[model samples]
Target chain A: MDAATPQLRVKRLRAVLQSVRPFSSPKIELEQYHTAADLAARILLLAQSHGDVAGRTVVDLGCGTAMLAIAARACGAGVVIGVDTDADALADAASNLRALEMEDGVDLVHSEVGSFCRSVAKRPRPAGVHTVITNPPFGTRTAGADVAFLEAAAALQPQVIYSLHKTSTRAFLLGRAEEMGYHAEAVAEMAFPLPKAYAFHRKSEGSVAVDLLRLTREPPAAATAAAAAAAGE
Target chain B: MRLVTQNLLTCQVKACMDTAATPDGGFLSYPLKVVPDAGGLKQVASPFDEGVAKSILPRLDWAALRKTAAELGVAALPEEVPAGAESDAGFLRSVYALVFDIHLEEGNLLCPHCGRAYPVRKGVPNMLLRDDEM
Candidate 1:
């Protein structure tokens, strides 16, 4: 396929992803909000441009119904792993994968982010994971949930991670990424639509400013030191 | 689950690597032997993308793939990735079959380390551990 072929495929896949239904969990504490398909496609395209994806192993943390996971596969990911704690969401994801004929490329694992990361870390892959794209809970319902996801994704040591978070917390998240030995930058910001799903929601439909972060692990101290020594620093 | 997926899995349960449990413990479980069910094996045609395969070659555990292929009675894969394997059309086709075409629809992935079994049903591997195992 030509260079533009994957881009066109991703466009079609994004439409299919938009058709997948969001989780209907009654508890807001679950933070089971679905990522808008257009936003996911944009993040994926950006990741592709940076050579963080395309034919690389991609992991989707807290993958609800496998929207990002499916998108990654459609864009030619070598392998896509979707980790989720909710069985119902995984079931839905499985159905969606079948519908899209993407069951072959994607694996939906029913597990929390932490355990999934640990399991993947134990795996013996020389190149390790290529990218992790996740839209974790915004931490509105549960405190520190987004951080937990970030911590887990960092633990996997992917080449890069593309994560979505509320724009207000961009500074704090970047600081945390720095502490974890990752160079993070907000690559894009957009209005994230939040449909009313709970009694506490004041508006039927509201949009919140959200940022897409691209995080890459910092060079090891030894490598940096060697480079500096070569330069006679 | 496809062999490509299995190629990336390792037994992560703590007890599975407990030195007290086995002699050669502490090492991650690899090449989890597949015990195929009566109708476990299936074949599906996948788009042959040489570029994707080339990109994945560096990341793949070549030794593990060789071992798994041996166990599965696939003799096409060589012990070592051939020189210029990336551009070799025949070798790339073989690699594609080993990675993408074959599927284990129903089976148990028996960890060589702790002898723990992870069941595969409807092509999904249940990697979740019990409470005590965690």
Candidate 2:
């Protein structure tokens, strides 16, 4: 049982994350879609491989049921904050933490993502949000909900943000990321399981194509330097 | 929430963000005071990772940490982050304790500016604002 291997680690992580309780009542309006444990392990492992998770301050925006938050903490994120608009989901997150015996492992905040960003922006210290990992609402129900989460993460000015979005919106989200000072790269594609939880969901079991996007904050100096180089050329 | 998280949280009330002046002339939303209930505080022993502590040290608001520590009855922190504090194990341990160790399981995070109280139950602070507050 050599956990040093990434494969073994992911297996263990997925097993632990599986213990997390899902939403008792999924909110369609909020797009309370759960990120499966296997997928969450893969994402967190990838982030850890890239020096993003371990000992980094990670914020989980719209952290429904805190699946990703728990994963991040388990993967050695120095500080993990799970912010969500829903109280019931946060209650579940708390129980998940206690169940995992990680009662103090993650911090849970109850706030809309937009306001949470605004409030954190006013901290006396410069922004300390190092990385943000979120499986935001795909905005299927509420128009622009996905982009709203992106905007909130960008406002924190973290070094990197990893978000899941419908693959169909790749071009549009890439454009938005550019406009928001991030260099967006679609890192991985996943078939996100859409377990039939809503009345509108027709299929008993279904999946959707999603892209895992890594939005790196382009350093202002580098951007300026590149622009200068382009101008000189 | 741990002080590490608290160090980053401010009052999210929309009116508070309008930059209303407090008596001391600080922005109303800058620091939300911690009001811990009796026997609400818990100190958990977490592994001290030097890398994490160093990365977070510079980003911390020392004044806010000091104020919160005083409220929680922790020992006084130095007025400033000592020179070369990153390599100072003792200093880092203290910082880790203040930031990551202390948890308010049940309490209220009262906003200094708007006098709004966000309740903390089961160690999760509810920062959700009402429509009127928003």
Candidate 3:
């Protein structure tokens, strides 16, 4: 028999795979798209490292199976929404949320990223919404896909935006964000393990570099002041 | 131990770099999003090595990264490989620094062949393809 993987999450994952009954047959088809332990730690890091997640409106772009959003809720985000284009994934996401007993803490959206971003940008965040988090795709190359996403994220100029991508992608990300008018900062990053017999990842994942970022928009003192004055009336 | 660093070290896909394009660069596919199994989460990727980054630096499509880098307001790197620094570990460190240290908080990885853009939100890259692209 193959030697057992020693990683804690790996061992834990193997157990889950063998035990968890499927909602209606396992959604194994979407297994390749779920978030693993390492990334979960990263999301936790983003929540804890930043002080508090309480009362923040989090829009999880490309939410895949809503794992991150659920984690965000557990970490104390006031509200969370999982957005994706896969209908089945959305259904699975809803089921997952129900399983976590966090269905009330989360919402699901079935839509494309760009259209979603566009719609959200057109309106102010409901009541207390504030942050947007995503793990966008970094196609075969490192920089191209991320550069475009960063540009779009900056357009809305949210106070904070967190994105995960390959290590081979920082220069373009930072440089592009600057050109687009937001100050980009690499806040916290951690490596996640990649197991074999999976899609997208082919190697025995050990420590491939993945980066996390915190992006802040430029100051709008003048606009803020005007808006405040108008509100005072 | 950035997840981004972990990926470039082990992504050994043959012909992985952007070939025939003016510049060549390796793909960094780690930092993936996975779902929680009853035991652990799925979709997470492996980490990379500092050593492989050095070996791969010279081969990176500098022209392409530079072009993309410039759009982000970074200084333009020379189109061709500069002399005297090919074998320098520091230079490779510079390459690793660029590839792994920066973050694309709100962006998408666009498909070079199809022009399809994948969204990157909250430090995660959504590299999913539409039914047609797949």
Candidate 4:
């Protein structure tokens, strides 16, 4: 019961989230492949190690059932917001938060990734989010969905972002992040397990090489000016 | 929505940002008012960590939280987080309740400036703006 350490909390979170069901819809081009609880915990742990999650505000884009969001909260994030367009996923996330007795720390928002990002961007700088940890669509079904999530997340200019993407897109993603004024680094690579959930998945379980990217925003001119002002220039 | 989130939320409508600027040229949302439905208030217990709460205290809009808390009939929150509140058990419990326990299951979060209403249904606030507003 004493989840005092980050490692212990991650283990507890994995067990709690494993029971939540993934939301699926054949209509959407992006298939709803749930991120394994262990993987989610690992990502949270990486973010925590980098001083991103603990006592910071975190936003999870395309948060299906809020696996990552819950993990972020368990890792000591002050507030975790999980944004998803799927009503079913949001409902499941709500239930899971209740189940974990974490309704207070985690919030589930029903909105598209772009809308949520823009809304957060519209807030004043002080209210701006600190970090974004998302496991977005791999773009297997939708050619550009993953990029869309990246674009929106970059717009918020969070201090740090931890994103999961297909390893094949590493080069393109790095280039894209550089152009968007962010430094992207592939911090970890793992075999992402794909459980057979849809009829199209021939294998009962498959694995794909995926990369966990840590992105830090390049300081904007305004930020530079503010920093100077703070230093009493 | 709890005061924890309400403290962070503001009118996302573009025009509301300008109104947030004070006469002294400082930026602060003039404490967004809430129309809470008492029937929809639900208390869901969550773990309370004093350290985490203390760490987040500096980032909170105390004025906004006080106003919102008063509106919700939980006026115990002080106008300012008292000195050494980190070790204050009563303060921590009150903050814990305001932040994590008090859930607004249904209501409208009205922007004091733009007058736009973000509806809360089933504990989720719909922050989507109108097309023209965006």
TM-score of chain B of each: 0.89, 0.91, 0.51, 0.87
Q: After superposition, how far is residue B100 of candidate 4 from its true place, in Å?
A: 2.5
- Which residue pairs does candidate 1 place in steric collision? none
Query: lDDT tens digits, residues A150-218, model 1?
Result: 999998898888899999999999999998779888777878888887778888998889998878875
- The DockQ of predicted model 3 stands at 0.01
Q: Per-model i-RMS in Å?
A: 2.9, 1.9, 18.6, 3.0
lDDT of 3 by residue, A1-233 (tens): 12432343234433332221222322333332345644653454344345324545566776766766766666566446676666666666667776766654465555555544543343222112356777665544433656656665554455677777667777778777678777666554567444453445556665557777666665323343232222121
Which candidate's lDDT is highest?
2
Tell me, per candidate, how large a share of the native contacts it keeps.
Answer: 0.54, 0.82, 0.00, 0.32
Model 3, runs deviating above 4 Å = A1-33, A124-128, A141-143, A197-207, A218-233, B1-134
TM-scores for candidates 1 onward, in order: 0.86, 0.92, 0.49, 0.80
Off by over 4 Å in 1: A1-13, A24-27, A124-127, A218-233, B18-28
- Which candidate do you rate higher for DockQ, 2 or 3? 2
Among these predictions, the greatest DockQ belongs to 2
* Cα lDDT, model 3, residue A3: 41
TM-score of chain A considered alone, across all candidate predictions: 0.86, 0.91, 0.71, 0.85
> lDDT tens digits, residues A108-179, model 4?
776667866765555444555789888888888878888888998987788888899999999999899888
Q: Rate the local accuracy (lDDT) of all candidates.
A: 0.77, 0.85, 0.49, 0.75
Clashing pairs in 4: none
